[model samples]
Target: MLIPAVAARLDPGWASRVAAARRKLWLALFHPRTVLEAFRGETPGFRPHRPFWGMRGGVSAVFVERLLTLLTALPSVRINPVGRLRHMASGPRGTVLLDFAAPPGGAPQRLSLPAATCALGLGAEELFRAAGVDYAPQRLSVAFGWAEVAEADLRHCPFSLLLAAPGAPALRVSAGPVAEGGRRVMALEFGHVPEGLPHPGAAEARRALEETGLLREGAPMRLLGVTSLPCLQVPSFDNRRAFQAALAAFHARGPEGWAGQLLCGAGRLGFDSMNEQILTGLRIGEP
Candidate 1:
């Protein structure tokens, strides 16, 4: 049977240091509640919060949510939705040890399971680095929020569009219309500016949206939000080589070491690849 609680314990000081090295606060800050909400919406038992109702354009979330719901219903599965992972290591008896901080003020906790039964969902680049793997981000994401357009008014606009210009930033704008009585706004995401380059402010986004025919030329685009994710990862030869080397080294320690445990962002370059990863994780008892 799936147990909500794992039968292991962890040390508070060690967990604290791991969390500090991982900079959990920075992770929490960079990924605002909106992004986390969309991520959580991909999990089983995801009920669209009132504010998130009518949200569209995140096709990956839709696909994964349905798939996970069906899988989680199988017997012997447990879901522990509370806690922040701090560290992972090998334990005695061919098991792996997962240390984390559970709710109520980051109390230390641990879970021990057979090595073959554990799957690391540490897809974020920062998380892998925290786990002692050396690699760098191949791409980053910058988001901009513009003036709200009523869904009814934008019925003709496509759910998403890509815009690029000769001397401007390329962007992918997606519509995320909240339910009635809530603020509805469209979001624009683009690649990060290179080092030493000044931010291409909201005006750039407005111009791109206009050129893409999603915004009127003279529309008042009152910027509502600006978010940056500097650690986004994508597949590249160097990244794959480094990742594979790290996995091999981790495995060399022991047959059941953390070799292939990392669920990195290598194959999740797009929505279709992400869906494939989700399916693979479920089939292999990783979910």
Candidate 2:
């Protein structure tokens, strides 16, 4: 339901631009010289235009590998012509559209825009920083899906309870049902509060949703799960260590105990196939 609402408001021209940007991103990621130049800050006279200007700031090869790894793991990406791509990540709270493009005489560019009343926060900032790109945040007029919940169950939902918990970080939470294949699952979203705004407590958000009639007490929803765009970092370029640590953590949590997993690129794992290792920790739907 939230997906259709967000889709209706998309700029018709964004698809093509996004495709162009994805292609450029692929080219930069695959080209060894481009990668080297980006890391060293040495512009080879005839370098293929970098897919993202942020790379010019100097990137670590480890970081680059991790970035590519994360990109490859994303379920919602389409790679066409080996370079151009289109991708979208949607949840109950909102959606994130990643568009890339290259214009004549201009740098290869990417636009990371949030939809469905979601706004960019520290995770967005860390994502761009890790990639070494500069981005400007733009706010949009869209509706959050919180209103769809029933009031009677509001106190029981994790979003409300987490916000009400002592020592919980100031956050903006959103929830709704998302259909994946034939199954519908509840998606709980947590985001950092935008800068300079008063921390709107959980009670306030709960009241707003209830007042709007979005909180329905009996919606027959099940399988409460949560996710966030958390900033993942490595002390150095040893991705293998990071991967091993993650793997150990996953094993320690077993299957059901694992709440959610981070979508990260390279640190200690170093070129290991994430499909066989890291991605297994993610709980996509009901157990």
Candidate 3:
């Protein structure tokens, strides 16, 4: 029998928020359980909190970087690291034609290949719009850093202690220790940092850590590095409509035409979901 459970949970106006929450919960819970069931041959069952949230804050650049490295290693994959896509259109024999803007002091290039063979790495609202599709996406900026910490202390640190004061620039600190370059490190991630505010340096980070007792007062610690992701999309009604239009356009082209839409570019908040998206594409894109 057909069940309307999903429809029942969604209400007008608030549908997007509810839907987003559902997705967040599913990704937080079911995804990990599925992974455990697959790799360990056991189910993790219900969890009080998303295990990775405390430790990693749901961000893992290393996973995506590794996946990209593997793809680049594949001889069949053609990567254009510097070239910019100028135009795209459907061509004969189920192929898609792509035009690349000439790099400085370089000639423009064009390539045609099976539509299913190509995948866009990032959102392409302008490209879709050029092709007569209405698409818009909103994005925000965020930053993260790694700080060397004693693994024992990180393990004992509670999630509540990692949170910032109400008006603090630091969004939340990750108590979980992650390995980087053979060194164990804790992550301090920030969201909505003031535009002109300088990044917290080693001293500032040390103070923050000391305040939480994760780092001993006057203890020597190193700030591994800091980086920012500028184009994290913010979900909204307009963006959803635009994304659907773009999807419909590809669907009209062919069954596999939509396969190129990468999960990392699906307007999700965090880039960590890229790994999940890759897994999903692999699972469903094939027969």
Candidate 4:
């Protein structure tokens, strides 16, 4: 499952700092208390200290709404109301942590939503509890924690695969040359992979990760389904339409980039809310 979330960039070269902040926020949300509440089925909220990089492209209320609209169009992964922290998770149990920046950043931050976009995710456990429902596992997690995928690893990697481990499984993908010498590496696909991938030992590596707890387990186990997708973009310019079209083509399945980018040229770009008309359009999940 891939969750595509977008935000604005404060500096052109703040990849490390930016990645740190993302990690912090994710950590804050994935706590024992929050995880517990989530299992019972409730929507939780979080607001970590804004990282040093300022705010990425998507943060304003309007952007969030537009994102919400995109959410509406998608399936399951709906935009839930932001509330106080409910349940979160306790981890180190293996969650695929990643952060990317575009060309400038040179690392994780560079791999972020080129256009203003990101993702709002809710796992299975959270879903059940939020809807006042029960699940067969009879178990669930409250929140997801922060993780860091090595920049070198993600550099040539295609996309991230999210799975509710202990059940779902690890995301099987190609390793290209990243894992060549059995170096316990991370993958960073500059943007999208060419073709005929599924790296030679990708499946084997995935199985190992599934059991090791890096690719699976931890928070996703209870959260329910997962979300992971491209929040990619090309370059920004006056002729934005041209840029959008090209980037859109790059937005494909399996470790690629985002289909769309947001037009963030306002004060400290933030998120938008698309509850009404915007909030009724899509589908996405662990794929």
Candidate 5:
């Protein structure tokens, strides 16, 4: 759903407040290190006895960071924000729409809730109560299989081929064409499951990767995605790497067939970049 449409249904002033809350939550989840100091101990000037309100005031930074890491590590968990008050979170378990509201004349006593309440099986009320947030609940409609959706979307879109390897923690090598400064350039993204069977060491993995022709020689790679298990983004790749060929190569070497399945889809450039901007702006300690 579009954010503006959702915000239009809320009270005039509430929209901005909700947007602020969404921003704060995004920052805590994506940029945990920036706010680590806040969670080292009881934050100064935070009076729990007083009617402290909003997520920044109500929840400890440590709790937020831990929750973010836990939820993102799950096999299934998607957070899509439609507006300040309306958020869509879904997983293999179920889906939820969080509709937030502010108590009149004072800040909320709680600002965030555990992912388990909404993502696992707990009810919405329980989630709000735990986070000390006051909110009205509404039914949420859900569609399953986010990976399937991605596959479908990329089926007809132009893209480059990357390799997928199956192991305890599956690995996906993302390579594709991206539009940059009026020209098109190749980009590579590397991701792996956060939890699972032990895998190769970084040096071994890198050595193996260099042999496969997926990445260019000495190409600079930057980390992205959730901080706890950031994905690598490489700006270029060797010409020999092809999607189908890589898939075959990965499959030939293993009985597990590259960690159960292969991922084929068009990569979206700048999506992560935009999200980072939002996270940086909403960092904790900002008034």
Candidate 6:
């Protein structure tokens, strides 16, 4: 199914987060039940609330819920929550998900995600579909992994290896290459982020992006897909081998239960620096 790009400010407080309704645009396009089931699974005895417009609303609710339920209950996926998520997106930023950060000089190896957790994560299509009319491609802000690496690093970095074939996009802490794509520039990430790259703050890079007109002024940063980017594809490794390698790495040291499952990323790849042409007056101006 097609998805949308969504930029939202997450409320950390449990109550506050729960109280906030799903994006209105999404609710308008699809049935609310689909949203609920994706998270809540089977909500037994879920009766439809009769809106002012009576029967029709009720029927609509039922239809939506059933469809969602089928989607949820069927043999769906056994993704490594984070890896699978990053694997499915279509953006450089969305692909570069940050997992737990390594302490200074700490040797880091693999990533792990649990089975149950708030699925704030999604794929590229879902992000776009969620955007609908609400998508304002300004500042792409996502969960920023645990530590906020400079956007400069993210842009040049890859999520995993020199080449992430399937699992995740390669993001390096240091500089990487940006390829020329027809009329667009495709940034290719490879290896780990260089330690010299700015840590907590990347305002300088942010400004540079704005100056270049890649990121606009008031847009809410969006987290495109799961943040825990894993190395699923070894350019030379066969698909089966890559899949096995990714799975084994996680299964051995997976995060405990729900705490591990939430994988997502918000870092962005500036508009291929094609403002004058592609982005020229696309107008949804800043947030």
Among the numbered candidates, top TM-score falls to: 1
Per-residue lDDT over 194-251 for candidate 3, one digit per residue giving the tens place of the 0 to 100 score: 4576766676567667766666677557888877665445455565666666766745
Error of 3 at 65 (Å): 6.1
Can you give the TM-score per candidate against the true fold? 0.61, 0.20, 0.56, 0.18, 0.21, 0.18
lDDT of 6 by residue, 182-215 (tens): 1212222222222344322234334333333443
Evaluation by TM-score, superior candidate among 2 and 6: 2
Candidate 4 lDDT (Cα, 0 to 1): 0.30
Full candidate order by TM-score, most accurate first:
1, 3, 5, 2, 6, 4
Error of 6 at 42 (Å): 50
Model 6 CA lDDT for position 219: 30
| Winning candidate number (lDDT) | 3
User: What's the C-alpha lDDT at position 48 in model 1?
Assistant: 60
Model 3 has an lDDT value of 0.54
Better of 1 and 5 by lDDT: 1
Q: Among all windows of ten consecutive residues in candidate 4, which has the lowest summed lDDT? A: 264-273
- Steric overlap count per candidate: 1, 26, 0, 92, 3, 38
Per-residue lDDT of candidate 1, residues 1-287 (tens digit): 00101000111122223222222111212234444565477533334634323324444576557766976897877766536656667789888777776776556778877786456665544344435555453444434445565454343466665443334444557766464754457776554545565655677667666767666666655567665655443334454466666655445543354434545343232212454565766766633
**Higher lDDT: candidate 3 or 6?**
3
- What's the true lDDT of residue 132 in model 2? 35
- How many clashes in candidate 1? 1
| Pairs clashing within candidate 5 | 110-132, 166-258, 166-259
* lDDT tens digits, residue span 6-90, model 4: 1111112223233423321111224555556666887644456443331242224546667669868987774333432132221
| Local error of candidate 3 at residue 6 (angstroms) | 27
Residue-level lDDT for 223 in candidate 3: 87
Q: What is the lDDT of residue 50 in candidate 6?
A: 43
